[model samples]
Target: MKKRRVLSLVSAAVMLTGIVAGCKSKEDDKIIIGGLAPLTGNVAQYGQAVDNAVKMAIEEINEKGGILGKKIDYRSVDEKGDPTEAVNAYYSLVEEGIVALIGDVTSKPSKSVAQKAAEDNMPMITPSGSEESITKVGKNVFRTCFIDPYQGKLMADYAFKKLNAKSAAILFDTGDPYSTGIADAFDAAAKELGMTVTNKEGYASGSTDFKTQLTKIQGSKPDVLLLPVYYNDVALIAVQAKQIGITAKLLGGDGWAGVQNQLDEKNMDVLANSYFCNQYDPTSSDPDMQNFLKKYKERYKTDPIMFAVLGYDTAYILTAAIERAGSTDPDKIIEELKKTDYDGLTGKTVFNENRNPVRLAYITTFEGKKEKVLESYSVD
Candidate 1:
């Protein structure tokens, strides 16, 4: 009877040990991240680029070894370019046990996600949302791209000094926070520099008919026209302005970064002297940038845009924070991120108190088939 009792106790101990081992295995296998992007909607191209870049970064990290010896898994949900949907997406990812978030490309969606993430104390980094308000939310929110004020000031200075344009007209999209922020900054800077902003015109987002607005701008006959709008709108406005015989020198913010691709040869010629600010330049002498281009091309079969580079850098920043924290604790990661001063593809990045990148904005112009870097100016 004594022997039988001892045998039963040993068997029970073995079963308990197996159960604990199973639970440990399950815990060790779970290290998932969340990506929020607009995979379907107006800004889908940019969102998809960001998503692809993040996925590439994850795959490269996993190939070496994942963080804390656990494989990193990511889930991307389509926000559909809606702010409310973006909020829902954030909650869903949090419910799914995602410790970090990368997402919501535009300013509106990023704003929505950032607000909720800040409230929950979740660590998040935006890839391409350049509105100034994003980082101002809290320490939990970060961005790889510089804000509109930086780009606006850079462009305003460039127009006055380099382009020799004293008087300019402002054409902006009021519906976009990004555009409005840039427009406001540009107007203030132009006024400070003694440059005359002859007229300021606002257009509704998604409006292709800008002839009337362009006609008004043309009437002003300013030396330059500063367009703080996106590529699609810029292209439409450029074509209409040309039709109405407005030959003023065109200038733009980073929203016009890829405008050439959206225009034909004839349309591009119409905006021949146009220049815009950009975050990354492939022609840069930075060895890190060169290596990034090589690796990105090898993986994606195409060169990366400023957005893609920003997305990749955003992932690296998050990974570095996680590695520095040595755990997935949200507060610990946020603390580590505040101390980050790493060199990214664009340049050396140091996050301010608001978690926005402190870096220079590069000025580039559409020179026929490519963009030419004119200059780079740092933010004061």
Candidate 2:
């Protein structure tokens, strides 16, 4: 077995010298991992949560002697939710000699980073990027979250089978692949399930007013309204929907995870009869789940969101692969990652051929600013 030691400044400089050479020095033992996320700007909540949880996981792993007897050196860059910035951040991390990557949290930037990472065959995993094309870029790429199509179809099936809804309406962002992907899947699934789609409206991304769409949807009087967008858009649309007297029950995908923070007591009524698909059950009674939640709350002083839990899972999954391989070779780590079957804070995660995890979808609703998990379902 290999031994562990803290690398001195001189030893670290030598490792960097090896990186500057043609090949990395295996004799210098320390695993370098890179993280990319929008730590500021639009989707800061998602990125901050992921970054915090990943750091927490790394701290715990280091405390336990780390993988392969080498402590992880984590380097993170903020992409600020921009695709170009995310690609730039990816290159920066690669220059710093990262063996593996976790991030580019949202869908668009994740796809951008994944495409670039594929060129170098870097083992990359996005914790909360639901875009299906993210892992399709390369075999070395994987994700801890389910794809957008899966989430859309899951919500559609839930609406039809569980809620027994006869009709539905959709509001999506035209510029966002994430929103449109889910909307398209939901439309097809709802139609296939014999539910009527009264109105399917698309608006430009970053639009503040949704009354035009909501008023149009009101004319159809659908039983449910689907908003397959991020938390900011969800908050805006919910307020606007209420203003237009749209009384349809609200439904959404995992992107709705942090929407509660965007609402106050006055507007909370808009989400009274609403539910959304999530990555995990926040109210789980399971011991592992409770322990994670407790630690996360103590560390961040806030309840862990789906992205946070996914980030925590990704760190463990990546390090576990490194430990199992017992080598820093990217190929060995990638192969070990392909066989992952770890039950994490979120749920059982087994990677499929596409490198998408097979996990349960949780249906959650807000109850007086607290999230209540109502049901859990799995889709093939």
Candidate 3:
């Protein structure tokens, strides 16, 4: 097998060598991978979790003698949860001739990179981006987590069939494709499932007070309140909901993955019996997941969120693809990635035509400030 070492002075210079030679680099002597995430800003939790987990996966893979006898070189950038910054990061990585990419943890930034990968035919995979349109950008794009459409419908079905919730209310951010997509999908699914959508309200993420919207939903007296946004918004709403005496069961998507890490016990008390879709069940009995959970807690001094598990799975999937293809060629990796069926901490992942994984999603609920696995369900 070909083997090369990255020079500290100009690690990515070798990738540009092939371009100067006029042919695409089929497989280099060394393997390189790139990642993008918003490591700072309000959404930093998701990005930091993904970054740490991806790094952990890379370390484990390297220790095992890496794919085809060459250790993998990885470089990740902080997108700061901004689309413009994410695109800039993508170009820098692309110039380095990375074999594959895992990144842009959020939907918007993920979309930015996926678009470039489509135009350039570069292989890219997102760890936690749930916007359904992400994969639509390019055939080379993929994701480790379920999409918003499926997740929305999955939760809607859960509310109707499992919880027997007759009426639902939704509070989402219209400006965000992630939030609106889920709200739209849930509304549609609720109607199809014969469940009543008592009230649906939209708000901007910057708005601190939700009294205007919450007041309307409170009057509806819905059995459940769907919060398909990130943890920051979810926490604020949780506090507001309780202050307003709203006792409805709260439901959310993977965006609610790391609630406890952000909010205190009293701030999260409103969601005592609430639940949200997650990428991995930290409390699952699955041996692989158990091992991951244990190691993650030990390494991070805390729990692993869904983004972290998805990021780890993204690294595993890329390495598995490289192993199956036996080369760093993007085309070969894409071909092998489509056949992926590896059991990960998240679950068994199989990529469909759109490059989205078809897998089960776990639901997490809190018990006395402790997040616990409620159950897992399939979209099928």
Candidate 4:
């Protein structure tokens, strides 16, 4: 009887192992997509928006009978806006057998993960990373926003022609590729527009003191200050610029993704009359855009910033590629993504040979936490 009991126990143990293996296989069977975001830092608002917006898209798609008749699984992780951390998040998601990736919202980390995705032959689409070099990593990589040259030139032209600015000063981060690239393009455009660049200076990333540079720009007394920096830095710079009595109009790129969240009521006045380049007009009246905004607000109980629009579009775009490819294979998805010209909430997004989307850059201005759309520009 004792021997019989021992044998039964051994049989039960074997059955348990089989059950665990079966569950693993079931999870592995589902098609997985990965997302990377900086969900815990100063710019966490952008990442959080991307994360939530994509998850909402995934849910909507699933409810309508997920892609290819299989329920889609998402493995999204936060990298805290660090490049190395972003790579680590990528590998973790890769282990879950993801067929494609979306994320690394900022340029530096997105560029890092894009290189890794290239090596792995993974299809990637960055919702917000605007660095020009990102798409050049590989054909497997794509983006939903225009690059710096177009954005910079557009800003310069707007200042010179729209705002009637005769001179500009640029202060950017030398260590940041995005900052430098936009600054270079702006400088060239300023020259072409016959606007003098009275001052151009570079400060390393994470530098707290911009008063020195602001003083120099104040001395130059330009009509506009091209502050091609991130939102956190911009908040500080904006305050300092006002303190130093530099009243030049401020401008920036998409790195100022969630500046409104960073500013207090007192600080909002400082950013008044400033403009920034953005991927989408959050208050657009286009029917499609209006629908998206309505649905997004219904889900989140608030209007979304630009990153949320991008995140939703990126997911929407990827799902389109998945349907077009009719498979979860990365190679097939990349092929389909390249041929895509989807009517997105942001704009009609068409990927170029470099897999970068040729889309409109909305010149957005702030009126004390209220975003006003100035105009939109398209690159040829």
Q: Candidate 1: deviation at residue 31, Å?
A: 3.0
Ranking by lDDT: 2, 4, 3, 1
Highest-lDDT candidate? 2
Global lDDT of each candidate: 0.82, 0.89, 0.85, 0.86
> What is candidate 2's lDDT per residue for 1-380, written digit by digit as tens?
12313424443454456446514433356788999999998889889999999999998999999889988988788878988778866876787778999998998999999999889999999998888888999999999998989988989999998888999999999999889999999999999999999999999987898898899999999999999998989999999999999988899998898798899888988888898998888788999889989999997899888889999999999999989988988899999999999988888999999999988888999997888889888765
Tens digits of per-residue lDDT, candidate 1, 91-135, equal 767766788898778888899889999899999999888888887
Over the stretch 83-173, how does candidate 4's per-residue lDDT look in tens digits?
8778877876776677899888988899999999999999999998888989898889999877877778888988987889999999999
Best by TM-score: 2
Counted clashes in each candidate structure: 0, 0, 0, 0
lDDT, model 3: 0.85
Clash pairs, model 4 backbone: none
Query: Clashes in model 1: which pairs?
Result: none
lDDT of 2: 0.89
Q: Which residues of candidate 1, in runs, are more than 4 Å off?
A: 1-26, 285-303
Tens-digit lDDT string for candidate 3 (1-380): 12423331243463345245423443566688989999998789889999999999999999999887888888888878888778866777776668789987998889988898888888889998888999998889999988888878989999888889999999999888888889999999999999899999999768889988898999999999999998888989988998888988999998887777678755757779698988777777788888888899999997777788889999999899989998878899889988899888878889888888988888888987777887888766
Candidates in order, TM-scores: namely 0.87, 0.89, 0.88, 0.85
Per-candidate alpha-carbon RMSD to the true structure? 11.0, 7.2, 6.4, 8.2
Which of the two candidates, 3 or 4, achieves a greater lDDT against the reference?
A: 4
Clashing pairs in 2: none
